[model samples]
Target: MGIKSWLSKPLASWIVQKQKKWSSDPVGTQKNVFDLLIKKAQKTTFGKDHAFDSIQSHADYCRLVPVREYEGFKEYIELVKQGTQDVLWPGIPLYFAKTSGTTSGVKYIPITKDSIGYHINGAKDALLNYVHQTGKSEFLDKKLIFLSGSPIMEKKNGIYIGRLSGIVNHHVPGYLRGNQLPSFETNCVDDWESKLEKIVDETIDQDMSLISGIPPWVQMYFDRIEERTHKKIKDVFPSFSLLVYGGVNFSPYKRKLIESIGKEIDTVETYPASEGFIAFQDIPGQAGLLLLLNSGIFYEFIPVEEYGSANPTRLTIGEVKTDVNYALVMSTNAGLFAYSIGDTVKFVSTAPYRIVVTGRVKHFISAFGEHVIGEEVEQAMKNALLKHPEVSITEFTVAPQVTPEEGLPYHEWLIEFISMPADMDQFAHDLDQEMIQKNIYYKDLIVGNILRPLVITSISAGGFINGMKKMGKLGGQNKAPRLSNDRSFATIILTA
Candidate 1:
């Protein structure tokens, strides 16, 4: 390896050592980190003599700060839009990471230099830990094809700004950055569609060993590659060895993706948001491990059972356990204290703090009072798909809607199928049967006839996910709503 590449390995190794030192001693590490953050916050204008004096003081301050959803940050976002430096933090934020949440309209999350370091280091630690766990160093040498958002940096008042996409584009090592394909200019608004086309065309023949992005977009790229090359992606990119994806559960699309790839590729699931890179797959066979940014933020978990209710118990990293689902809350370096992002996760293990995302706290159908969660729906769908080989779902969504006849509410399914079952009515019946069998709550509701029969709306190939993407609703950490209980979604499904 050349000097730069050789140096990167050592640097990456150092990051791993540093992270292990922090993660292993969660309480002690957080206390020290929190003390330092409190000092910094106190020095800042917004934090000057403001309630918190120490780490515990900071946590207490956060608890009293009144948890704000993404919408609460809109005023700060407007400051960003104006290129003003009057919000939280010292210097002007380096860039804004474009994202949207359930309650938050399109947002531009600020990423300061310090915040960027936390994200980059978290990602580095994840990579190095993967190497340490799997004993595989080949990935470090391979060409990684990250199917990221557009790298275009928008300029405001002579200062370049955008989302994490822009920051990452500008901040990567010069040598590797130089090796990357030409980035799409963010300043040019009209080039967005063309940029995606360019990314597809440039990597069609390359030895792309590692692919990373939202599953839908990654699949879209593969579909584009197939259409352009007139060959299956497996044939075109025969050297593809790993698929690293985040932003949505791959379980629903796993079987189809695996079959399409024609070989088992090492898969890594990441829980990265525009806010920060929260967790990533550490060991080869394990799901994602939560590598908490102990230094950058105070993490809190509200038990899933208490979700949407007032005063759920808050859990620190040291207090979490395996298999219990919790809604994630974070108090970050960039002045967000005790903020709820509304995502839910389940710990796979607590010894090393591994987590598997359960689903969104807000994204569920509850018309029959069954409290159906995203994970439950995904699991039910998986079983249904597995049992009926004749019915291959390309895309689907679930929602609770009130029928016009009696105005009684029920769950509706909008599904796109690659192949229809010979007996359509039996297929629908089996779908309900599998859901009832796998999910007890759903079964109880169905048995009582409180929930209506499974309503299936056939859509075209790649319709649901693609349509969502076209509507500017796709990103790394956001998935098309699997369960939308609102009238807007109901109207769309009915009209479509």
Candidate 2:
């Protein structure tokens, strides 16, 4: 039997059992996972300092281990860099996932054997759930391509360092290597354009069935494939049926992807951070991603408004109510104790605990008291697209035009359009209107004339690409910032 056929039944069975348990007792499963996480790390230095042994309840875990960000954990991370064993977890991490940072230079996230298991299981369950929902396992017979970073790792203080995708690529099991694509050497190409060219050249003729990556990069691949093949992606690869994406809002890229594919296909969204794999689209036609409760990560939710307060109330899985935006805090097997990864989410369902990503804690524009978040911007854009079907935004960023040289203070938008709207003024007006409806603070600012109407700046083709290249973050999971408090990124695009 083929590898997929051999593994299909057992994998499906395991996922069925997991889903049964998950739906039945999410809270109990969460508690068990939390206890397992603490027990596994109890002998470590972080555990000792945090009093993990005495942590018997969620409240105890919260009280003992305060919510921390990367800055707060930097000292311990430095210790790990200096070859300290068991500084955070029971042993040294196998690798450090180097995250691209806009504020900080680079963040080295610990990737232990236990943590890697979480990543692998998350991917497995994502596909297994897809198969369970659709009853379509035929795609498994063809190649599964991940537009990922180079698997070649760099050594930093005796630990391997690379992007999370690249690190995960190295761990792709031997059994599935035959179905994975883009030669390892091609992935190692540092330049974005060069990498794209190589990937297109390598996979243009292959029997690709599944493609997974961040939307923008995957779109780039699709564009390149079309450019080379002179046909739609579906025509080029008849078996191509699955597209898995995350790391950015899919709403903006949805039209572009669908247009490129030339037909509808199965699409899955995932929330995989360097810190941990948090959630994935499980049930077909579900609105939100089902939270991974039994993963080796204990989750806490703090209300976004109270995020920076001296003592914000942190809620557990069972405590969170639907539709409340909360910043996610996680204590994981990788030895991060109550670490806040800065992404915000809102629970949409309580029965099985599903959530939608709202925005980032830091990624917002409120320079003139007009607080606007990633979700608001995305929704507004979606609303604009609905009104003007001709236009589609490929990528965009918004910044406050605080010190206007030519006009009053306003929000500045730098947009890379797949197709321009018929009426630019109306399009911009509709977007602003949607934002006003969604955010009361923004509406107040506009109504009071504290902020001028938002000004839309059309970015020329490849503007985002050029800007990201200038920022030294051209590829490999690096995406353009959607919103910024300042015009640093927008200025670069405007100047370029």
Candidate 3:
């Protein structure tokens, strides 16, 4: 038997057993996880400061710890950077995962030895979950490719720092190394173009069966592969049976991805962040992801409307209701407590809980109090595409033009289209009308002459990628923000 087959049977059994336990008593399991975390770190500085030993219930924990963004944890993190042990967790962090977050420009998220277990085990269980649900194990016998960040890390004080994906690559299990593609040397290449070319050259002839990456870059890689071989991706890898992705809504890029594949393949969505692995698609044909309840992270939800207020109500997993948009707050083994991760989600199921990412907390344009969110803008674009049936957007970002000298203030969309529409004016009008229909505040602003109709700027070829490159955020796991409060990205795109 192959290594995967030998491993899959026991793993699948474990996953099935865990799922039954979780579904049977989700509330009891959640409370046990919370209690274990608090007990584990009661002697640490963060816990002691917050009276963790004295805390007796969920209410006590909530009342003692205020929800905070990374800025609030900056001081504690600085101490970690200087090699302080047992500050946040039991010891200094194993490493810090760096990323470009919305509020904090360059965020350094801690990854403790304990916390890394969650990521590693979560990934293993996710794959096993797929096997348990689908009864498909042939893909496990072939090579799989993950287009990920460079694993090259730089030392900060005594801690290593790099992208989270890169850090995880260094920890791939020994048994599964043969199933993974792209040599370590190529993966460490700094430039994306050079790395992608090397990867295409390395894995083009392998018995590749699965691929995973963020959607936009995956499309770029597939296009490059097809260009070189003069064949579609499926032709190159006949065994390619699954595509795994996350980090952005896949709906906008779905048609293009399917066209590139040229064949039917199962798609699995995962919800992983630098902070922790949250959820993954477990069942075939399921609409939402199964929340990783047993992972080493404690979750809290704050109603979207209550966010940015002085004191938002923080609800535990037991208290969360289905279909309500709530900003995600997490406390993890990495020593982050009651921390806001800046993304929003809506629960689709309460028992054996599942959720779908709704939008981002910081990605919105509310200059004129329209309070437009990423989901609203994306849905509006989707509606416009449905109506026009001729245009396709590769990428887009919206920002406010508050002080345009030639026209009234408006929301400007800088877009890169795969196929341009015949009449740009009508296309823009359709998007504006769709937006008004979706958001009452946007409609009121337009009616009051407080804001002009939305403006569309057709970006030149490679404009968005070039802008991302210039901003030093051009590769794996780093996605361009869908909306920005200021015109920084808009100005860059216009001038690029």
TM-score of each: 0.88, 0.97, 0.96
Query: By lDDT, highest first, what's the ranking?
Result: 3, 2, 1
TM-score between model 1 and native: 0.88
Q: Give the TM-score of candidate 2.
A: 0.97
User: Model 2, 18-119: lDDT tens per residue?
Assistant: 777876787888788888988988888888888989989877876888898898889999999888999999778888999876666789999888889889
lDDT of each prediction vs. the true structure? 0.67, 0.87, 0.88
Q: Tens digits of per-residue lDDT for model 1 on 395-416?
A: 6788766664674456777787
- Model 3 lDDT tens row, 204-293: 999888898999899889988989999988999998998989899887888778778898689889999988999988886788888888
All candidates: CA RMSD (Å): 3.2, 1.6, 1.8
lDDT of 2: 0.87
> Candidate 3's C-alpha lDDT?
0.88
In candidate 2, stretches whose alpha carbon ends up further than 4 angstroms from where it belongs are 1-10
* Ten-residue stretch with the least lDDT total in model 2: 1-10
Candidate 1, residue 5: the lDDT equals: 43
| Candidate closer to the true structure by TM-score (higher is better), 1 or 3 | 3
